[model samples]
Target: MSAIRPAAVVVLAAGEGTRMKSATPKVLHEICGRSLVGHVLAAAGELEPENLVVVVGHAREQVTAHLAEAAPGVRTAVQAEQNGTGHAVRMALEELGGVVEGTVVVVCGDTPLLTGETLARLAAAHGGDGNAVTVLTAEVPDATGYGRIVRDDATGAVTGIVEHKDATDAQRAIREINSGVFAFDGRLLADALGKVRTDNSQGEEYLTDVLGILREAGHRVGACVAADHREIAGINNRVQLAEARRILNDRLLTAAMLAGVTVVDPATTFVDVTVSFEQDAVVHPGTQLLGDTHLAEGAEVGPNSRLKDTRVGAGARVDNTVADGADIGPRASVGPYAYLRPGARLGVKSKVGTFVEIKNTSVGEGTKVPHLSYVGDATIGEYTNIGAASVFVNYDGEHKHHTTVGSHCKTGADNMFVAPVTVGDGAYTAAGSVITRDVPSGSLAVARGQQRNIEGWVARKRPGSAAAKAAEAASRESDGEG
Candidate 1:
């Protein structure tokens, strides 16, 4: 195969998205766990554009920040005002410096369903026909709110793109609509953009105007209709966002199930763009896996759990837990109500009981952390037992510290360890102990306030004592004289 031409991609994301009624940038709004711009950029990345320029305006900083983190090395151009599409392209052109040659693909950032294959096909058609402009078109039942493509009857070439507001009655009936995506010869696009005028009904320069300019200049302008119209749907509000998300989620979910992953309820289980599951991995209803989470073979997740940036090894079971950036080894079981924060790792066959919170800790194989405990910044060795309400008190007012409990160690209920402390191998901590110092290997540590009892204390403290009796007698004598 010949080398793919070095094409430049310009993503138009300058709209204020006023209809979305959100302070966040429109393109930054997430669909299926990724921002809309992210999906668009990923599609563009597949084509390996020589230079990717994203045009930003409203909430430019937010858009730039998100793209920078998600897609490093993507170039950005700013449109300072709410100008029309043609003006947005002009802003990006200024950032291009020298004249651009070869094919250039322009896509809307909000069309998350447009696949890389569709873009590649558009480019291939544009190059194959030697056309100056190839407009990506789609035929929809209702073309309202879209530009209609007008073609010459004899040559079957694109004559012009007429906006809905400016189209005549006959033109408005055209089934073929402009997809707002295009592949253009770079030099011709730059020259034609200058010739477009703001004399249309909207009093704004429409990028569609360039089709007329190119045709009038005696250049071949063509149109390639997309096989699927839904791919070009643009999101302008929350309802549309939902529609786009549904489309994206359906595609991802179908692919996962076909790959042998078991989704008990695909409708209720939400998976992000980067989540993957191996064969025989079961995801129950109400499970949400977000941000690069992976489940190995034979792992069972949820009956209503949320996992983020975590990994589950083979045969692991995680139920009703909220886990973030944690690792669970094979055969380990976690939660009906547990939280595993960043850096928490459960070893093979270990169990994290209900209502427990573990953060920045590592539990060794066969270790069991029973109900109602908080384990933070600690290390527990193999076969250890941590009783109910046992807390590794890792924080002092000024600083945080670590606690280490060695292999075969047993901790009783309601025990507190003030770190930096160590309970050595085979050691034991008695119930109700407040440990502040290290305990040597094979030793038992029990620190608690001594219990004391006082008998007959209530009787001795009664008010009817000698002093009270005298006062009562004086009062009786005074009342009798009165």
Candidate 2:
């Protein structure tokens, strides 16, 4: 038998996903912070395809945009209309232009959990057996909605694929179902795809029809049964999307736990596919780590926190916070209710308190922002203390400015530093102050309204009227008593 030729991957992603009920493109809907197509593309990359072609429709622009951002160098073809799987592949073939000879693996974009190993195994079986077509099959208990694979009892070769809608009672009883993934001789696939017709009940060109054509043409069509049926599941609705998410999460969490990461409650802790954690990194329940997040050894993550595209250094602790595009250094402590926006960085041993928000700012080592503060577009030196209710008023409606606080500085509660101000090292701001200018090193700045007393002012305003009214009331009461 000839060796398996290098294969090109064609991912079908043209389904409208009407059941999903959202404006977002179906393939672009995320599973663990990654688009469904993104996951499939990563798996296909493992096979080292000579070329990768993704058939996009529905929201073509949105799907292409996401693919461009998530996986560069991937080629795309537009399926202008919602069509059957066979038609989708034919649309993608236009991008290949002339005829080429190799294996062509066609897979569904929504089956994100299809692993690289399974594809490799399928390709090997196809080439080793010299089959003209190889179909990946799984024996699912509930195959009600899937296409049942009809095999010849003697040869165990796939004779046909009967769609559930058209299958008889006995055919529906068969447990083996077609996964819609196929590895075919490139030339054979190109030839067979042209022969497919849209005479089915749905009035769409069916890919399964190609199996019968291959069979009648004296070509050997083979089927490889997958060990796990879940590998073949596809996402078309929100319920299935959630199921895929749970499965993916379980796979990642299991791998991490085996690698020495501590996941306290895997059920409630959601980790993305690209997230990594070192040994002894403990993740608490209700924590969601997404989008290339990393936690170093000894780091601890929350009982209710969400982190994305961020890094947490060793020994850092994050709890009940929402952080994105931020870095927490070693030994730093952040939030039971803090918000760390993009570009926020906390140095080693730094502390961010409850209700504090940090945006586009950096806090030096040991610096503290303790409760009820907004530190945006600012830089704080080491060991500085930002008191409760202190704010770096960074915006003036039209523009944003920066505030600088030097080392060892302290700001009292309710202090407001209007932007374009600086507090030198060791400076102090009194409580209830609104600082508008720079304060030199070691100086104290107190800006507030002066206090005044008005004790007897109320008594003088109602002076003689009080005694006259009292005597008049006494005389009236005496006359009434007589």
Each model's TM-score, in the order given? 0.91, 0.91
Question: Per-residue error at 400 for model 1, in Å?
Answer: 0.9
- TM-score of candidate 2 versus the correct structure, residues matched by position: 0.91
lDDT of each: 0.90, 0.90
CA error at residue 464 for candidate 1, angstroms: 21
- lDDT at residue 348 of model 2 (Cα atoms): 98
lDDT for model 2 = 0.90
The list of candidate 1 runs beyond 4 A from truth reads 1-3, 153-155, 449-482
lDDT of 2 by residue, 48-113 (tens): 888899999888888888888888899998889877888888887778873548888889998989
- Model 2 residue 468 lDDT? 57
